[model samples]
Target: MSSVDICEKHRQQSTKTSFISFAFPYSHLRPCAHRCKQYVVGRSYLLQLQPKNRRNSHFSYSCEACQTEARSTSTENNISTHALSFTERLWKTYTNTATLLTNLFPLWTLLVAVLALRRPTTFTWLSTPYFTFTLSILMLSMGITLSPRDFKRIWKRPGIVILQFCSCYFLVPFLAYVLGRLFKLPSDILAGLVLVGSVNGGQASNLCTYIAKGNVALSVIMTTATTLGAIVMTPLLSKFVLGTVVQVDALGIAWSTIQVVLIPIALGMALNRYFKSFVDIILPISPVVGVIATCLVVGSAVAQCNKLILSAGISLQIPIFLLHLIGGICGYFLPYLLGYNEVVCRTVAIETAMKSSAFGFVLACLHFTAYRVRVPCAISVVWMSLVGSGLAVFWRYKPVQNLKGFRSDLAQRLRQKRQLDEMK
Candidate 1:
């Protein structure tokens, strides 16, 4: 043909070749491009979807699609890593047998004490200074777990603690007395039950409060304050309730309580102040220690079951023990009706039901050689623990309807304020 035509044909061929080469890759890239476009759109949609001011910095759509994907993958990895670490720690702390032992120590101690009672001659050492020393160790551990900061918080909000003490000292005792008379329980069993009801809250109160999503700080303060107060209040209330049946040495009981509860706790708190690190290290182990003590105490009590049965007779005293359960349930709910919140009500309820039965056991051993009086104390420890723990678990997972209402009110108020500011 012509030179110009040939030049034109050559140009067309070059253009066609370039188009074919680009098209081959372009077809392969379509899927990736589409995915990138979709990811960008999805991110934008999510960004626009968030509540005002609630969108996090990482959630912003300023990055390119590839960068956004990388950021999301990083965030997911971080979240999964954190979650796994948390679960591992939780399993190590709670699911382990060591932790269970810590939680059940008190029960075990009581059990051992009771079993030793079966052959009092064989385990005479339990009645010696060693028993007192062991109890003192438990008290000290409890105190170390507490901080002055807890007391300060309680001082700021004293209402709940005061209410808990009132319910335990006044209301519960009155109910127990009235019920004991109505039930016509055996004189010894009634006396023991009344004494148990009159005493302050147990150390387990803190654990239950924590489980129930109640105020741990408040529970701790109440436990500490009431424990100190119990030295006086327990005796006076006991005298008032049990005086008709048996003479109670109010001052003597007060001294016993002080020796058992106050001295150990004070020693622990003092040590914690001086050796803060030691306290911190032992704090986690405190629960384990407590569990062992509990188990020992329970086993000891159980070992004396024959004596308890002989002195109190299961039939006669079973009714009194039942009254304790009923009284506890009543005491727990009454406070709720009197305008107290769930946490305070739970604290009061548990405190009202469970006494330091270990103290009661000591008193029974000192005052009465009869197993009848001690029977009630032995039963109190196991029953209160089982019931209180059940209640705590129930409350912990209970639907948080009240919190939802509070959040709703807060949101409404914020919306109103924003509208007002706009008008201004």
Candidate 2:
């Protein structure tokens, strides 16, 4: 029992309850506030808290909790503050469990990859079409969570978004090409790396941004912009980069990307806009659903290419890891040096580093000239998930106390301009 409840237990049952109610001199007291909730006992008696009880019209009442502590010999305080009630405890447990599961995204992906390698039959049963369907579902889950307001965030800081877009599309792809070639990987493996680099940012980046306490709204905006642009960008980049190595089916890739990624996301946004009530009901579970879909896609890809992955070993693995790690490093430092806030730096880094491996896998499987290309996509999924999530967890503990950055006058001018715009 709470100390207050225990002390008030016996006295409450009896009509004559003695509470400490002091009458202050008029000058000593200000106005009485209801927030104190100091007069329950006094009200019943109509003797301590009432106006007639006042001499110079100044009555000061003690808190019930304070009265309980003063009267009781017990040391425990109220359960509301120091202790949690049944429901409160239950809710806390549930949230903690959810956060734990959510943060372990890398573990789940890695475990499934290991299992797929050891026993391909487990995930191999889920065919290419299933992976494709799941990717569409993942895209749809992201789409449902987006609204016009998400797009509007771009207008608030067009400069940051533009920089982020350039970083994601330009820096990552260039890094992928350099790493793939510098590692002296085979033509198909190089193609795979290039394909993964060309794709849009994954929905997973949004989750990581949220975990890192970065600009989640900006992350979502960047994700949406790139995803919508992927239809054109993915095919063109693939054709240009892989033209000599493989007969790139630019048209096929574009058409399939539209069917797999664009259609579902557009449909989802339309549903969210037109059927908001239904969307609200499912919105809470969408992120979990997206995670499940993402896991399935990654596991399926890894299982399908287990023999190749086993053969490639670290020779292939090093480039894939560098593809993400270097991309993320460049993503963060570019923004930081240019004077973006830490939150923006984190958001841009995650978006740039984390490829839509699921989407890349689908495209590589569907349209690539060589089967080995899909192997990189599969491994990229595993590596990017690990790298992005690891960075997020590392940054999560390091809280952002200052919104303004120290590196550049550009950020200050931007902030001042935004303030002026808001004022106007």
lDDT of 2 by residue, 396-418 (tens): 99988546664655666789999
On TM-score, the leading prediction is 2
In model 2, which range of ten residues has the least summed lDDT?
A: 1-10
TM-score for each of the candidates: 0.66, 0.75
